[model samples]
Target: MGLRWAVREPQLGDVRSLVEAELACFEDPWPPPFFISEILAEGRFNRVLVEPAGALVAYLFCAWQFLDLHVLKVAALPVRRRQGLGRTLMELAERHARESGGESLTLEVRPGNLAAIALYEGLGYDRVGRRPRYYANGDDAVIMTKRISG
Candidate 1:
């Protein structure tokens, strides 16, 4: 892990690269407008991990729902996968959420995405339920949640 990096909110100017990250990580990618809306939403955000040169390393888009933080999307570039970038971003998200009055962190992952499942589990999240036909490809989404207690 590197000693220093930057995690900041995605801006309108970064939509193109954010969309590219979405395309690289997901088969059903979100469009530019969706990113725009989230970027403008109060308390909702698209956070990015960037290199010194400002290239995207990984990103996490989260939605604020009541007292919970829902992870809408998260991904590291294919070449950057498994380098703890995702974990670092997640840790930062958790701390910020906790400070922002969030009681829990929640997310949905495709049932077939074992790596993501493992990562969430390792982060103290537990399977809470499942949503059938959640994805465009008809994959079930495994819902996971972790209560935040300090």
Candidate 2:
């Protein structure tokens, strides 16, 4: 194996660590059962970025429906922020979605999350819509979408 990190489907053992990372990344982290239901229960497509030593550095969860992959959440360890982990996770999900017959990716990010918005924008995601008071604190959500194929 090369020095590259491994990004793959998340296993059961990743729930707690992934939740911790999510908590660090969001003010209102998702509950444990949410992860279990979406990822481990086969209801959704989930992937993680793990270091060579088996540490989960990042993750992305998507609700795959028809040809659309709705990104529920993507997060990396707080200490690992700004290191392109989020982008790497996005790329992995995009590749997986394409291989799985998905034609587009969509997500809703809080308007206040400038970093995440910038990341998505840089990756070709554009604002397609908005949801009023979509966040826990009543912040608007900027809905973004990227079409991966014609």
TM-score for each predicted model, relative to the true structure? 0.94, 0.91
Q: Which regions of candidate 1 fall more than 4 Å away from where they truly are?
A: 1-4
Against the reference, the lDDT scores of all candidates come to: 0.87, 0.86
lDDT winner among the candidates? 1
Tens digits of lDDT, candidate 2, 43-145? 4778888888989988889887778999999988888788888898888778888898789999999887889999999999999999999988888899999
Q: Can you write out model 1's per-residue Cα lDDT over 63-148, one digit (the tens) per residue?
A: 88988999988889998988898888788878888888789999999988888888898899999999999999899899999999
RMSD per model, one decimal: 1.5, 1.8
Q: How accurate is candidate 2 locally (lDDT)?
A: 0.86
Residue 133 displacement in candidate 1 (angstroms): 0.7
Give the worst 10-residue stretch by lDDT in candidate 1.
Answer: 1-10
